[model samples]
Target: MMDSNDTPVDVRLSLRVNGQMRQLDVPPNVVLLDALRDRLGLTGTKKGCDHGQCGACTVLVNGEAINSCLALAVVHDGDDITTVEGLAGEADLSPLQAAFLEHDAYQCGYCTPGQLMSATELLSNRKVGTTDAEVAEAMSGNICRCGAYKNILSAIQETRQQHAGAAID
Candidate 1:
């Protein structure tokens, strides 16, 4: 509906989430995090601080990681968004997810989803080198108060190596 000034009264957003199309009619003020969790029931994307600084609401928008809480859902219309839940296929875990488990990267697991999302983006981009310091710096945005940085770095590094090996095979 348009108002007197020819402005839209309601906004309809459509996005491709995890290779699936989703539609939502939300107000322009609704944030992407809220729409993903509250509207779409994709709760894997946590809302730790609700502020962009926390990085708990990290998600991939068009293959790039972004803090969903800081982006409006309306702005992401027509974008391809991927959450943590979409990282794995129906019967398998993503390499990063498996590596996190094998490396015991999470403690309390509150930040695991965000960590996985960030790492997924990083690994897919292949811009971050296969080094502890490089992985740590790339993953610095996602904070794990549990202080499991070593294990997290290990997981990311291992996954990178595994993917590289698979590519070679």
Candidate 2:
């Protein structure tokens, strides 16, 4: 029975979320996703299998996506965090978002946020290319219950093509 105003000491969380600095007070047992959604109110990171079996709790820690549910909010102090909600900016969708829309990459969208986070990490890496096998390997961790794997890869490939074309021009 935790009551309000009980030990009102502010816990410090020095982290970069979506390129912004954030310092928050959270309980010791609070998982990263819980703190992000419940405290920071960033809900793009979903919770599918709170045990990390599913990749629905993905978010980037310093550009590398992680399963936030498996991490305590306290452990991530002074780290960078990027949720699916942080992917876009200035009223514009990310290239990945645009490609997902163009290729109908998702169905129901429960797993979409995780897929997006994984895809964002993959695309951010300069080594990943437009190969189907490559995309499959990269996204193997994310499970789309809707089974939209083919469409997901297609959208990723399309985004790579667009990026390549832009780079060439």
Candidate 3:
């Protein structure tokens, strides 16, 4: 329906973003990436291809990774969204974040946020194998133009090992 200006009215969305409740009034067509970055001021989720192919707009929706650019804001009402900014604590980075830093998993850093989000989901999923090939396949959607795949894989493996060891102990 059109408002007084003859423009489509915005829809209200309630989202749990980065552990905090957020409310946004956006046009029904607004993608989740735009809602997060443009409306919520969470710019870490990049808008790369804007098409779902690049995965640059990946974010965790209810603990699963999804291309935010492909999701409509209205459909995800009350969903828990985690941007790259939400991965860390008040003083320290998440283990995966630290591993990424220690392994130098990023170059240029534009795709890092999406990469991190994807890796986070992958690590938590028990079905995905720990082999390098497995990890690469799992992360295929996120394209790091800088070709930092080697380091990204290394970081993921290292974090997996660390977590495994911790679990054993």
Candidate 4:
């Protein structure tokens, strides 16, 4: 079984993402965001500040949010990753996306992806309820310079109402 001709020059890393497992040969220096956006063509994860200050590069790793910009592509092999594009199928949008739109939660929308990621996680956690203050505190990690906090909080609160049977998300 030893064939010198088949010896690969680089190792292929496997990535399990959005319920699919894929592999890629990436250099050690490449960041996860670039690998996902550039190589893999998963462009939902945006690049904002790039220094971890702006949470625009947020993605979910096994249901927990992580800054894609700071993660190394070569290191997270076999990990389950969820980007903004992974949230829904085809034309349908996730409830958070609909909620954000209904409340006009974004201005330029540069920070919308990260905001949605944080909001999605916070909303799912029973500990973080629908109160304006709670929503505000939970979303503090993702900065929206557009000052859309009020609307964002309203949207979260409104989404919560849907869960409680108001039937308007």
Question: Which candidate's lDDT is highest?
Answer: 3
Q: What C-alpha lDDT do the candidate models reach, one value each?
A: 0.90, 0.86, 0.93, 0.81
Q: What are the per-model C-alpha RMSD values against the true structure?
A: 2.1, 3.5, 1.4, 4.6
Q: Give the alpha carbon lDDT tens digit for every residue of 64-162 in model 2.
A: 988999999989999999998898878999999988998899999998999999888877577865679988988887899989999999988877777
Against the true structure, candidate 3 reaches a TM-score of 0.95
Preferred candidate (lDDT higher): 2 or 3: 3
Clash number for each model: 0, 0, 0, 0
Q: How would you order the candidates by TM-score, starting with the best?
A: 3, 1, 2, 4
User: In candidate 4, how many Å is residue 96 off?
Assistant: 0.9
- After superposition, the stretches of candidate 4 with alpha carbons farther than 4 Å from their true spots are 1-11, 161-169
Give the higher-lDDT candidate: 3 or 4: 3
How well is each residue in 1-169 modelled by candidate 4, as lDDT tens digits? 2238864344478888777898998767788899889988988889998888889989888788888999988789888888888876688888778988989999989888888887767656678766788778877878889989888888877766666563334
Clashes of 2: 0
**Where is model 3 poorest over a 10-residue stretch in terms of lDDT?**
159-168
How do the predictions measure up, each by TM-score?
0.92, 0.87, 0.95, 0.83
Of the candidates numbered 1 and 4, which has the greater TM-score value?
1
For model 1, the local distance difference test gives 0.90
Weakest 10 consecutive residues of candidate 4 by summed lDDT: 1-10
Give me the displacement of residue 160 in model 2, in angstroms.
2.2
**TM-score for candidate 1, residues paired by index:** 0.92
